[model samples]
Target: MFDIKQYLQEQRQLVEEALRQYMLAAEGDFAAHIETMRYSLFVGGKRIRPILCLTAARCVSDEPDVDMLLLPAACALECIHTYSLIHDDLPAMDNDDLRRGQLTCHKKFGEAEAILAGDGLLTYAFELISSEQFLGLSLEVRLRLIAVLARAAGSLGMVGGQFLDIASEGKEIPFALLKTIHRSKTGALITAAVQMGAIGGGAVAAQLQALTEYGGAVGLAFQIVDDLLDVTSSSKQLGKTAGHDAGQGKATYPAFFGVEKTRALAIEAAERAVAALVGFDERANPLRALARYIVSRTN
Candidate 1:
């Protein structure tokens, strides 16, 4: 049996180690600012984005130390993810007090510091990906990776989705628009994680296309499951404020479809994600398992 739990733990360790090595040290004149960034970055989380990047690379390449080769890109994905979380928990956004079971960056470090920390992480992600450390990839490939990440994290993607989500609060929105919000806000970065791995691993066009499809399905499943958890789970279980979406009047899968229907949708998306991997061999088993895991995750 492919033990998904063990696989997640091992991959998460690799991601955490890489993050520690590549992240800026909180010292010197800017110690205060950097410390806030480190505080949020080092706080506990699933580390799913970076793990997806590494696993997607493994699916395409059997090269020696392929995970090591893609560490910079993987770490960059995590940085961007962490930065988003920090900003999301700000008073102007979700206004949550807890994240990953710890005080939010803004709550612990003040609003201005949290904003700067988010900004620092966002900019540092690009710096890491563009730096000389991400060796083995050609200049063209590197540029492509950068572009993919930028588009996913920028206004057209996550930012745009967030704007739409906030705007739609307290208003009943069509299901189609809700999907658009989810796809841009949550799905784009998740898909980009897989795409970056494929590009870095030298996947051919067909392989990239298949992986992209898989990424899209997985992203949809992930957001749906999140919506379900928001309604079904507790804040303690989520390590953050649960039911905040309902309180904020945010449109969600559960809001459109009941709990059971929303859960069914999540399963359907996971199935589609798995179907997209039919072209790959056993190397893609992790991706398949991850798709299933996304829908089943409790937090």
Candidate 2:
């Protein structure tokens, strides 16, 4: 009997507080750039990645206190994610002015500052993960977590997706190619979040496999929903400009599968995500609920 919303709210507060504390602690010579870094990291978002880490950890164990210890690593993922958004919204990239209902980083702070801020946050994220305060996790576990994160955030993962996106622009794309982009761009980090949570909780092979499967489904579902929202929802409802995908001639689920088929695909992905957690107890209910929320959400 757990209140998933309350748990998510509490964890979001903790992650935000930890992020601010981490940003505030940056004082040695980098004070000027810290504000811009903090601006995007602390800006309003659902904190879904960190919450996924916490919730997945809960599935393997019930140590609520570990959340504080895990906060830095969880926040690291968010930092990388936020950095991607900042760069993605740049004029050279998506040419976007707004994100999450506010001016983009490049808009609020000049493009140069925004680019540096993204770089600063991306590097700082690694520093946080490698810090000594990670609850004395063994080197092997830490190395594995670092590897998972690096691969997901690096050229082989998110970067590859970005490349595919750029290359596919204005071209007639096959559904398979679109799936590859979504899997790499969106699915990798989502998969990494779940893997990191499983690692944080010291999960073994079977549990890790289950969590990975769960993350993969939900990750693709998230992208499909995002594609659908871009066409069906509004900027006000989405908290960012809608139809920007089509406007940019970007390949998307809706563009290829049509809106109705894309919606069905998202629902199917949600069902698969839920099924991935079938082995876990009620401790995993939050993740299951999150899967539903992913598809059901208006924004």
Per the 3 Å backbone cut-off, how many clashing residue pairs does candidate 1 have? 0
Query: How do the predictions measure up, each by TM-score?
Result: 0.99, 0.95
Instruction: State residue 153's C-alpha deviation in candidate 1, in Å.
Output: 0.4
For residues 1-299, write the lDDT of model 1, one tens digit per residue.
89999999999999899999999998899999999989998998898989988899999998967878889889889889999999988889889999988999999999999999999999999999899877778899889989999999999999899889889999999999999999999999999999999988889999999999999999999999999999999999999899989999999999899999999999999999999999999999999999999999999
Top-lDDT structure, candidate number: 1
Inter-residue clash pairs, candidate 1 = none
lDDT (Cα, tens digit) per residue for candidate 2, span 108-172: 98999999998988898888888876655667877887899999999989988988898988999
Give me candidate 2's TM-score against the actual structure. Answer: 0.95
Off by over 4 Å in 2: 1-3, 24-28
Candidate 2 whole-model C-alpha lDDT, 0 to 1? 0.86
Predicted candidate 1, C-alpha RMSD = 0.8
